[model samples]
Target: MSTRTPLDVFLSDQALAEAREQAKIPGTLAIAITPAAPGTQCSWCDCDIALNETEHRCKGCPNPAAVIMHQFRHGSPVRVDVPLCTGCHPDAARFVLALAQAGGTR
Candidate 1:
C-alpha cells in the first residue's frame, strides 16, 4: 500500500533519471587532468622560488571551492601547490594561521 502524489512521483522519476545520467558520465567529466609540473611563483605573492621547493598551499583557508569539488568527485580535498621560498614560508604560515583563527571565511 503506497500513496504518492503526482509531484512526488515526478520528482522521484526525475531524480532516478538524473542519477542514471550521472552514472554514465566519466568520473572526471569536468575536471582536467594536468601533468605534474612544478610551479614557479608563490600563488599569493608571486615570489620566485625553486620549482622543486614549492609547497602545496590551499587556495584559501577552508577552501570552499576545493571542498565542493572534492565532495562532488568523492575524493580528498584538492591541494594547489605554489612556489614559496624559505624566507616567505613563515609569513605565509602566519597568514594562514590568522585566517584560520578569524573563522577562515576569507
Candidate 2:
C-alpha cells in the first residue's frame, strides 16, 4: 500500500525531464499516473506502470474497465497502466499520435 496521497504526488523534475527526453517530438509524451507506488508492472502485458495519473491509467488502453472492473477477470489479472520507456517502439508512434489527437495531458 502507498502512504502518499494523490495530491501529495506530482511529476518530479527528473521524471518530467526523462519523460520529455524519451517522449521525443515535443508534446507527444504524457504520464499515466496511478495511486500506487512505482515499480509495479502489468501482470498481463508485463508493462511497468508509472505512478503519475490519479487513477494510474496509460494511453491507448484497449480496455478501460478491464483492470478496474475485476481483480482477476477471466483467470488473468487485469493489466493496469505500466511504466513504459517505449517511445521508440513500433506502436509508440500510433499511441502518441492518439494521445495528441485527444489533446494530450490530463
Clashes of each: 0, 10
Model 1 alpha-carbon miss at residue 54, Å: 26
lDDT (10s digit) by residue, model 1, range 67-97: 1110112132333343344444456556655
- Model 2 has how many clashing residue pairs? 10
TM-score of 1: 0.30
Native RMSD of candidate 1 (Å)? 17.9
What C-alpha lDDT values do all the predictions have? 0.37, 0.37
CA lDDT of 3 in candidate 1? 50
Name model 1 segments beyond 4 Å from true: 1-39, 46-76
Number of the top TM-score candidate: 1
Error of 2 at 39 (Å): 8.6
Give Cα distance to truth, residue 88, candidate 2, Å.
11
